[model samples]
Target: MQPTELMVCTQHAPPIGGAFVVPAPPLPLVPHALKPEILMEAIALLATAVPLALVVALLCATVVCLAAICRAHRTDVVAVVQALPDLALALLRRRRP
Candidate 1:
């Protein structure tokens, strides 16, 4: 083997010194595979969340309306008081020592 044949001169040459450093190219802010999927998943979840929130709001509104309709007329306070449990009445009556 000859020493002249061992020499390689191309753009891909290995650097000679320990102090020599090649500056790295800038990294992308978002990863390649994850970029599109993350945005799509977030939008899908947001779409689902909006409908779920609306259903919950409608259920709360229905309950409030029903309660108002049921309480349109007042009955005797004593009759209402007697219908409650004894423990609840005791708790409401006063603070016990």
Candidate 2:
């Protein structure tokens, strides 16, 4: 084919990069049911309630953790004290070597 025909064919072909563009849809004009004042009040109540709830949860968790730690420490102390005789004998044997 002639160069002019090729040029004409290329010009008539679908434009490049056209697929990348998209037209935005029209927005609906409906008014919101929750107004700014109601939103702010709800947010304020949530802010207060969330921190209070968190503090209560933290206190409960801390109490549980402390109780667990105390129980574990007591058990460990008892075990270690019971083993004192064996530990002393081992120490004496090691010193002679």
Estimate the TM-score of every prediction: 0.41, 0.41
Please give, for residues 3-89, the per-residue lDDT of candidate 1 as tens digits.
243344333444456322345556888786478888899889999999999999999999997787577555644565567788686
Q: Put down candidate 2 lDDT per residue, 1-97, tens digits, no spaces.
A: 2234224332344434542223454565753537778788989999999999999999999999778667787878678779999999999999995
Error of 1 at 22 (Å): 18
TM-score of 1: 0.41
User: Candidate 2's C-alpha lDDT?
Assistant: 0.71
Top lDDT hit: 2
Q: What would the TM-score be for candidate 2 when compared with the true structure?
A: 0.41
Stretches off by above 4 angstroms in model 2 are 1-33, 73-97
Q: Candidate 2 at 87: error in angstroms?
A: 28
